[model samples]
Target: MSKSIEAVKRKGKAKEATIESKDQRWHCRNRITLVFGSNDVEELETYTYEDGKLNFKTVDFHQAKSKAIEEILDNCIDEYYRGHVTEIHCELSEDGKSVMVEDNGIGFPIEKVPQVYSEFRTGSKFKDEETDEKGFLHRTLGQNGLGAAATCLTSDEFKVRVRHYNSKKEQTYTFIDGALKVKKTKPKPFKGHSGVRVELKLSKEVYKNDVVDEELLRKRIIDLAYNNPGLTFYFNKEKYHYKKGLLELAQRVDPDTAQEFGASAYIYEAKNTKGKKVKGKIDLSVALNLSKKSEEREKFISFVNSTPTFDGGFHHDRVRRLFVNSIKDKLARNAKKEKLTLVDNDILTGITFTIGVTMPNPRFESQTKRKLVRDTHLEKGIEELMNKNIDKFLRKNKEYLEVVMERAKSRNRFQELKDASKKARKQKKQRVEKLLDANERKKRELCTLFICEGDSAIGGLRSARDKLYQGGIALKGKPMNVAQAAISDILNNQEFSDIMASIGLIIGVEADVSKLRYSKVVFLADSDVDGGHINTLLTNFFYQFWPELFDQEAICIAKAPLFEVITDKGTKYIETPDELETFRETTKLKIKEIQRNKGLGEMSPEAWKHVLSRESFTIISASDVSRAKEMLNVCFGKDTSLRKELLMDEDSSSSTSVSVSSTTTSSAKKKASKAPAKKAKAATKKKAKVTKKKATTTGKKKAKKKTTTSSKKKK
Candidate 1:
């Protein structure tokens, strides 16, 4: 450091920095990042469609390298815009170091081919105030004219072939080492479609890698196909063609949930410098795939003029804000009624928007064209499109509105959910005193929770259960009917709190099956009507809060055997009396003993094993939520009359009782005999009066017949 400092201090004179200007090829090769974005590889989170599915992954992306290829493709898209092209083909070489793009279009004049591919600021798309004979401004993708030239200048070898339609002649040019060496073929007569083809290997010195990514290249080509509905694209040999491009892309995300949001072709007139009124058209297409169950943030795959806008700009912002506001406005009244405020995420979450806009002239922030700048015409067109279609979309998707409302409610209850989550985590860590838990510490989905009716039932369950996969928890009595109870009361009840905590359930939050401690919650109660009531009560509790668990077939019932028959061969557990009767009628083995179990606590160890060893339990599910909710309300609501009506209806419809003991029947007869004697005597007198009336009518009829007979004899 001391020697360096002395050398610097002893300097005699300052030398001026040398200055020189470089050619277009050198400038483009050395400063490629400025023209084509980043030359270095970066990790980009994106998705690709492969093998009939969309796969999202982080991929190594080289923006500048990709942009170089895109420049050649953009020319074809611009030609397509002018109605001169229909089909485009792109191919990657075997080594993956070079790519080729060709289009079927009216190729430009043959003489301008070299300059077009070698010089900067040279192309046909520079006019901003000009219009065709139809007085419409040209809609094109390559506006700056530097893209193709820059790509060519930054390539190791750029080969171009052009067949001019009017000239009926073709020529080929090969520019090697950034056009430092050039070779040309003589113009000659040619056959086939008139178009341009470009093949190039990107310069490794500039891009750091020459190899092109096949998946990303194919994705880009497919994106172009989707952006232009009528255009056809061929990547390698596979063809990609779509009529409703953006909508089809949305469908690719989720076929059942995808739909077209809106489409509009807006034409506006503006005055040119010559005072002539020229028209400009903006074609916008939007599609969306919305999921009610997804908690992920919204995603936008947007494009402008057939260019993929990876970094969304004004168009994305405008459309997203408009969509969110429209939903919020539509749900404002409902939110007010529920005392909740609608948020953007409530409307925007779980949505994938595929947006494509093609306009006469589009402006981008950089040469890579990854984002679109603001345009007044585009803004007005989007507003008009949203205004025309948003209400219809809202009207058609009423369930979507309900989901949004639920999201708002969840947001408002965030603190309560947080507290529940904390309590559940604490409970998960602490050992529960009454829980006979499974030995499986990991892979909790393999575990099953047997919610027993009483603590005595837990003894048999613990002894008979598969310790690795089966767990047991006992309730003091019938569980709380959550349909009629407040959430606070449910959480405060020790039995229910333990059940929720043991199963990793949060009351206000939706259940994620992967996060649950047990894959199945099996209600193991008595075989009697009281046990049935307890099962229904527990069903009501789980279904009222986490109906998704029911949808997933996680809520189940393990039938406790009513009759444990000791056969000569082995033991057979029969769940119902009818089943026992059928077994008696059909079984070959002789039954040694038929022991009826009124409750799970009375079951033997062998019977418990028979119940627990079964492959599957009876899944409790509701196909129609509204009907299930109504029935549960009738069964468990605060209204006593509804319960009475339900019970009376069931009693009148059923000729035989489901389960009745001999002792209960005798007690019922005793109560009937103990009714007051006065009332009993009154009932007997009413029956005697009806009998006397019938007897008198019969005697009168006999007397009338005898009178008629005597009169006839006298006559």
Candidate 2:
């Protein structure tokens, strides 16, 4: 038998009981079975209403805790939005365990306080249905009263205090672990103001070792202060006051507006063309961050009934479309005189706006109210209101239109240059493909192209490589690091262009993977620090442009030998430091000379034959694509300060092991301290000099100065 817990609330108490059943099924409030198995299971179900409204039945631990906090916060904000309250204060406990919200709004009736926390779907917001004389709907932030009750059920300790001056009464309720511990009601002094205060600690059973994220909490509180015109919030020894409302909020979020385009604001009390009252009234505030043509910035934030609509549903779409159309229509009338064409992006390149809608009956996509659904009547009314207001605003600010026109023209020119670059790259790719030998063309199915670091490294590879199936592209030096290079820069790079052509695939936004020339594209660099950097740079290049190549197993890192250990039995290859230590401690074979490979050029043709063989190499891959992107950006992005911080962290760490998807070799280390260590150093320098001379004779010009290696080792 399996056990599941169910919550049941009575008149003034909340209770929980565990029921054992052989069926081992979990049912939601709507009697929908969310999960069924032969053992106990934790399941979460969403109850969807007839109108497609969905609410959480049982959420995950973190989500449940967050929902509990949001529920309580929503109740307080709802009262504030109704215009009854002006002041709200929130406090997080010093220990980071509990939080409290207090609002000076019209308090609930003292007699109904017990049922409000103990019952579901029971509250004051659904009492009215009539529209006001001003054409405003009876809209409130919250309709159903399940928020407080849900919080009570999900919390280990919950308490609520209410005072009603009009009724001259006060009530206090407390509950522990979903069960009511106490309830008290009495007459108030009548000299004080009325309000509600709620405090709760999330249940440990549901959420283990989790506390409210303070930064996230701070953002919500600050956003509320900005969205609500007259609301003042105090939390964590700070006071967040917003009197100028959305206009002020816009500037705070996107501060670069002042430097980029000189901001503009258009606030209007929207009215229909006939100057008569519409079905619903709307107050629109648009704060635009008009930028210079070169800048790229786009931000949009919207709300309905003082509650944030994060997904930006009907209202957002309508506003964006109509706003752009209004500008386009005005610009088209003088298109010949201006000598420019306007597109949607022209008017919205650097724009931000906050809209406030008041409707008698609002339709939201979900019970959480994250998105607003379209209603025909509401749409028509908003359209008429916005068209009239936007038209007038444009006429008053003709200079803003001029700036928008310039931006659109700049975008058009930029697009033309991109087209030209694409054509050139396509032609260059064909030229590189023609350079392939007959064997390469015949063995395309099994062909592997190795991208060597420099000319010196390719000679050994060329001598030992299987020419029928294996091709080599010798980069002059470390080619332009594609991690931070632009598309034009990458296309212009001879090395990059050749690699793309050799691989038989276009490397860009319009890349076609189906035309790949090689079954495998490997980065075969030196077994030193410079090689690792080159490997990282090339990986970043493919990851940035042809990310699908990684998914198809077309991109891989060749596991070049770090140290070649000669023992009495045979020569053993070692790839990592950890493995080398274990081999030294466990192996019984008499140790001979250990060669620490400084670069791929240091390896002889015989060693190259062994390393390049199909069985001797391992392919390196990203454990996850997102992590690879983050690592690449941090290490190779233009942010020098961030890179410095990362380098500093590396120096402080004890181990410098890299975590990749997989490795093939068992024992490897860059440093060898066995017999003939002095001979190994001299051998490395002699081999490097010979490789350089051979490369020069073969028409490869060595770099004037050796590139600084951050470290002379690789994993």
Which RMSD values do the candidates have, in order?
Answer: 11.1, 22.6
Candidate 1 residues lying further than 4 Å off, grouped into runs, are 1-11, 419-715
Candidate lDDT values, in order: 0.85, 0.63
Which ranges of candidate 2 are over 4 A from the true structure?
1-64, 128-136, 180-191, 207-209, 254-280, 293-297, 333-343, 395-411, 414-715
Residue-wise lDDT of candidate 2 within 1-715, one digit each (tens)? 7787877556866567977553111121111111101111334332211121222244322334555576677777777656678888888887767989888887878778767876767887774343345545345666766667766765677888888756766777777766446545564554567788888886665555447756546656776777776788888778888777766655554455521111122222334455654344444444554444435445556667666676679888887888888788878866656455787777876665555565544677655566799967557756766765775676656787888877865675566446645755565447563233326665466777888877777788878888888878788777677755655666777777777767765543444445667777788887666676677677767777667776666777787777788999988888766778898999999989788778888876667877778653445566676666666666667677755454444332223234331121111122212224666778999999999989886653334322233233331
* Candidate 1 lDDT, 1-715, residue by residue in tens: 4655444464668888999999888888888888999988899878898886667678999999998899899999988888899999999988999899999999988899889999899999999876766778988888888999998888899999999999999999999988899899999989999999998988888888899999999999988988888898999999999998889888888898899989999889898888888899899999999898999999988899988888999999999999999888888888887778888998988999989998987999999888899999999999999899998998889999999998987786675556666666566566577888899998898999999999899999989999999999999987777755544567678898888878888776789888888999998988776777777778778877788997898988888889989999988888889999999999999999999988888999988998999999888777767766766666677776865554444332233222211111222223334444556788999999999999999999999999999999999
TM-score of 2: 0.48
User: Taking the candidates one at a time, how many backbone clashes does each contain?
Assistant: 0, 6
Please provide TM-scores, in order, for all candidate models, with all chains considered together.
0.66, 0.48
User: Could you tell me which 10 consecutive residues in candidate 1 have the lowest summed lDDT?
Assistant: 656-665
